[model samples]
Target: MIRMQRLIPTGDPARPVEFTEDAQPVPAPDEALIRVEAFAPNRGETFLLERPEPGLMPGKDVAGLVVQAAADGSGPRVGTRVVGHPPRGGWAEYAAVPTHSLAELPDSLSAVDAAALPLAGITALRLLRTAGSVTGRRMLVTGASGGVGHYVTELAAAAGAEVTVVTATPSRAERLRALGAATAVHAVAGARGPFDVVLESTGGADLPVALSKLAAGGTLIWFGQASRTPATLDFFDLLSGPEGAVIRHFHYAGPNAGPNAGPNAGPTYGRDLATLVRLVHNGRLHPEIGRTADWSKTAETLVDLRERRIRGKAVLTTGVVS
Candidate 1:
């Protein structure tokens, strides 16, 4: 039987995440089994473990070699190095990844970088797209130094948007500017803007300010609620004027975005993965990975993430688990 590492959580991550051995999976007619070289946890994974699905493994971005192929042509060939987004099983030593979710990695990029691409990259791309054309527009990004937020800043800046970054901490302010912000403002200052677009990843008192900055026809897309504070908006803000705003919430794992999405959003997963991986491989874009931890230290990594001590991505290398 194939061996793997899995997480089983009964309470919050303050408790130890149990590591267990399990039988590795065999591919059905269309699924491929991935030998996970590296996997990274995202916020969603933490939410998953604390909820009803206590047995869920907390990683979606996976990079590794394809050790087994499907009977059909749907799966990758044996020994092909690739970065993939597996639904729930990626934190394990081996995962049965659906063929449609796997994207081939270019030889030019390292597996570590490849492992970092899919989740944050796809979310960023999707975030900007939903905000519509950003060219020459004024945009603001909250948590501009974060995993998805940094990429959002870079992507929007690269698109020629005049980006204003709102950050809560001073440490990330410089890096936010370096990521291509026309202005970097602390969350407390509430920078001036009739923003064409505003995206909030950090919430709390800053939410209304980010929302108010949006210009008419401008859109605000917020996903994460890391600030652990309540946010309320007044319709009077988005009601009128050329500088009025639009607000929308974004979450890839929601009704229209994730595994349970409808026919209209059918199979959009690998599409973004393909585009993001290609950009990384071509040296056009790169994601920031804060640190790499082994599977044994996965809980510690989660703690660091929760504490916001690390920026960008934190990944775990399984290192030949069998």
Candidate 2:
């Protein structure tokens, strides 16, 4: 067995993760073996790591070079540069990635940038697909400073939607606007809306306000609860909003969630990632990576992410590939 260095949980809150040597993974017939160059940390994954399960390993989004192609010849050939979404264990020197959840990267895109595109980018893509055409719609995005929010705002704006973003500070407000927001305000209360579509991720008190902003028959996609507080919705909260308004709970891994995760069919993670990469290559979509650091700082990085110190995606370089 070939031993490789990887990050593992320490079961200590103050030092939640530490590095260790583990046997290199063998790829499944439908999975490719990757020499991981970089990975991105997400708040949701970090929260789980804070009190990790006995065998849990943290990692979701990664980018690197394929050391071995899928045994069944399902994905890119060996030596291909790729970005991938593995179920877990991505914070390692090597990871076995399912072919369907991997996509090749262009030479122009760096491993760090490609690493930023998986979980958040795909979530944004599927949600936008579910909302249908934003070409002339009014869209409101809460929690607009985070990775998913940035993608939602930029993609909607690029599609000709009028985007009103809610952030907490002037700096973030400015960044949101530069990402294509038509308007940026300090609070949801500052947004005057009869929005055709609303992407509500920050839960707690703000969720009801986001609901109230939707136009009649408009859609509100609820994907996250970054506030870590449950939303309380009363009969009045529902009745006060426009009639026929819809609230759709979004899960990137839902049964019907495929490449599009919309009303359309045929969802594959590879195809969805490919679309995002193509958009990046064509200068149509830009992945906003706000923080980058060496892989040794995984524990501290998670702390910063939880404390709201990092603004967008947080990428870690593994130094496994140049």
Candidate 3:
């Protein structure tokens, strides 16, 4: 039995995480055993922890070294540094991940930086792709200072879109501009647009405002509910114009939504991850890692994340990289 430390849910909202010892996972024919160097928590995982069966592991993005290669020789080789999204969880010392969900990390990226990719990065990429070609299009990204929002701004700008960012934190405006956004504002209201594309994550009242900003025949991709509140909108009025906007709700792991996607889907996660890694390597994109802490501080980190205190992404290290 390979002894390893893993974070499990405690089923209590106030204190959601607890560490426990578990046997190291064994890799399958198409899976690789990773020695996790670092990992990041996602808001979606918080919702999962509220379930009755909260004892399961609770992380999705991880960066680590391959301890064991796939039995079928289909994934990364042993000793390769890789980042992956494990379906069950990843906040552990060792995890068994499907090869197709693993992306080899670039030499320049630290484990902490790579850990911040995967789910957030892939979600951002898919959001852009779902919005169709952004070349010369006028685009707006709500929650622009966030993990997915930052990436969407950068990627869209790189694709020749005139990117504007909407952020609750006023101080993040300059940083958002540095990330390739043509403009950054605290509120979506009063922003100049009839935007060609709107990638919205702030769900509550902002949803209707975002819908209103869309240009006729434009597209709006709603990908998150950061506000955790219900949004009210008059559908008839919102969709009344002759060139009504196209509204799409995107879930990265939704059925048949990605490459080779299935009930246990994630192959496309690896491909998108690889693309993001290349962009970072080539200096075309920079993933923001907001903070880093020891794995022992997992509870505090999660609280900060849940409380919306941290900016960009928060990463937890297993004391492997200094």
Candidate 4:
């Protein structure tokens, strides 16, 4: 049994998580036994807890060392420096993760930075990769100050895309500009668009309007919904327009998601997260991590995130946020 932390979801993040002294995990043939040094969870984990799903261990990202190798040599050998986003077991001290999702942690990255790479980094990478003609293409990233959207602004700008960002906080405007966004508009900014690709990281009332800003044939990838509020969109409204466009609902929970998490096996876990790690290693993708929490205090911050106070990624750490 492995010592682990589990959220006993009761609609409150401030409450201390249940400490499980012993949790057992079964490793499949293509899995690795990782000695989890530190890990973090995305916003999805919170929502997931509200709507319980059996066998779904909430936390997804991890930075750790390997402890065991399988008979088929399907996983990284023991003692490999690795980081990954597993389908589950991220908040635990030990996790049995698919080898496909693991990537070698670069010599340059600390465990804290490695912990930030998987979910947000790869989402930005894929969004940039599929976003066509980014060179001089007008781009708008909703929730531009958040984890994934912030990186989208950075990578898109580096790709020579003229970036326009939409953020909830006015103070985040300067930060967005620093990340290479050509301009930053507060939530009240009038309908602005003609964006080649809109990274839909925030969902709610402004969602449809943001989608409307996409130029004809423009694409929008919906990766996250920070607003507890739901969206109401008419397909025809988006589908029929002078600038008739396309929309791709993107959730980074897939196989080719990060710079390292590789060809996964389960229905939802395989993605090349390694490519994301490589970018951070090469300096193409930089995530604006606004806050971090230790396993000791993540519950408190998660509540803060749920309350809409998070300006950038709120990373949960085994180490303090200082």
Residue pair clashes in candidate 3: none
What TM value does model 1 have? 0.89
Candidate 4 residue runs with Cα over 4 Å from true position: 1-16, 51-56, 188-191, 234-240, 253-271, 319-322
Candidate 4, residue 271: CA error in Å? 6.6
Task: Judging by lDDT, tell me the better candidate of 1 and 4.
Answer: 1
Local accuracy of candidate 2 as per-residue lDDT tens digits, 217-249: 999999999999999988876987799999999
- Where is model 2 poorest over a 10-residue stretch in terms of lDDT? 259-268
Alpha carbon lDDT at 152, candidate 4:
80
Report the lDDT of model 4 for residue 26: 65
Which pairs clash in the backbone of model 1?
Answer: 215-243, 215-244, 216-243, 216-244
TM-score of 4: 0.85
lDDT by residue for model 1 over 73-181, one digit each (tens)? 7857988877788777787888777788888887787777878887888788878777778999988888776688778888888889998887767667777677777
Candidate number with greatest lDDT: 2
**Against the true structure, candidate 2 has what lDDT?**
0.90
What overall lDDT goes with each candidate model?
Answer: 0.75, 0.90, 0.84, 0.70
Q: Estimate each model's TM-score.
A: 0.89, 0.96, 0.94, 0.85
Candidate number that wins on TM-score, 1 or 4: 1
- What's the true lDDT of residue 255 in model 2? 51
lDDT of 3 by residue, 5-80 (tens): 8889887777778898888887779899999999999876776666637357777899999989999988799999
- What number of clashing residue pairs does each candidate have, in the order they appear? 4, 3, 0, 17
- Candidate 2, backbone clash total: 3
For model 3, the superposed segments whose C-alpha errors exceed 4 Å read 50-52, 255-267
Worst 10 residues of 4 by lDDT: 264-273
Per-residue lDDT for 153 in model 1?
Answer: 84
RMSD of candidate 1 to the truth, in angstroms, is 2.9
